[model samples]
Target: MGRILDQPYDVNLQVTAVLSKLSLLPHPHLHEYLLDPYISLAPGCRSLFSVIVRVVGDLMLRIHRIPEFTPKLLLVRKRLLGLEPEGINIDHVTLLEGVIVLEEFCKELAAIAFVKYHAAASSSP
Candidate 1:
């Protein structure tokens, strides 16, 4: 697996693909209900989609105890980094740091999952 900064193009492409797939899944239609198509038609829609996918993916991973979503979280962190401005507002820096913390936490969870999985495999008959 590649680090978020190491393979940004691949990460963004994968995240976009996953989100596109998720959009097809059956669920309450958030875009239709909450977002106006006119507003959503602009570049803001892509930013909104990225945020939604990142958040939903993180919550699902945590709820299900799945480690595979670590990379997705990293991808989101990368996206947030790109959105940061040159002047570096304190609030923005704090938010970016929060995202980094979340990514690191996810990585730790993934490491634990790897260890558990290996232990279980080794102990199995």
Candidate 2:
């Protein structure tokens, strides 16, 4: 004996088919991230984060870009800051959050770069 189909398909397959029919709404932030270098954490904070994220994203994109680094970074953040996930979709939220954190990391690196720049300038005398 076999179960009857709702519309000549398996229930799970039908659900997935229906879900797949739904379209992703276009996100301006994501589009801006792709197109504009100026659209970032802050004006001075832009270049450093942009370069780092672009490099990382480029490397990851070569392997299909699963966005796994976001969660891993969040895990590192949790360990360092004792933060915890707030909701069910924490993984998705971590993507944007991780970018912001990486931006801050880059900003610190930029500070180091600035110090190096000043040191070189002073030493050239």
Candidate 3:
């Protein structure tokens, strides 16, 4: 999963991702990471989270990000409701929260991987 982000994109990785659902840590892992504890998490958020995470990570560094997904999602909702982009107002703080979620996710995942690597290395002598 970490490798997917670090490496350049490829179809092979895409296929493998679909086939394995990223091996337990599927796309919903990121969604759940982004959402509040009141929200539900599942493996069904691949497409949305893929774009959201990319956009959030691309726009800001992890340390200073706010990962609120609602406002961005509201844009899509507006279009679906046959409304123009500017027809609706956005919650700036909520939007920032969504971006922050993505940044926190990267930090948390990296820390977990770092600890895992160390545990394995230490056990190996």
Candidate 4:
């Protein structure tokens, strides 16, 4: 997820937007550290901490109401849990772009999270 922001302009607008929103952490330094790979952090505890903080911050931001998804998600939830059991049917054709963007976003986040673990494990021995 962090790397997506550094990609060229040809990247998908929805993916960029999602990444932007996700990386909007409360502290400027922390947010900048995550988005900017050039910023140097010491290689042991601080480096690991920064990665953990960024991933956690991104996850926290994702739980809030995103304008593009909140209404639709609420409707879907209502339909599933409320009176309209049949309304769980979604129009995938219309939602294809959103679905793809979300898929990419999830994959990116997973990659970012796992990379830290992998790097740490590889360095240990």
TM-scores, one per candidate: 0.32, 0.32, 0.32, 0.29
**lDDT of candidates 1 onward, in order:** 0.44, 0.43, 0.45, 0.48
Q: Pick the candidate with the highest lDDT.
A: 4
Of the candidates numbered 3 and 4, which has the greater TM-score value? 3
How would you order the candidates by lDDT, starting with the best? 4, 3, 1, 2
- Candidate 2: C-alpha lDDT: 0.43
Kindly report which residue stretches of model 1 are placed more than 4 angstroms away from their true locations once superposed: 1-91
Cα lDDT, model 3, residue 107: 58
Give the better candidate number (1 or 4) by TM-score.
Answer: 1
Off-target runs (Cα >4 Å) in candidate 2 are: 1-91
Clashing pairs in 4: none
**Number of clashing residue pairs, candidate 3:** 12
Instruction: Point out the worst 10-residue segment of candidate 1 by lDDT.
Output: 30-39
Quote the lDDT for 98 in model 2.
Answer: 41
Candidate 1: TM-score?
Answer: 0.32
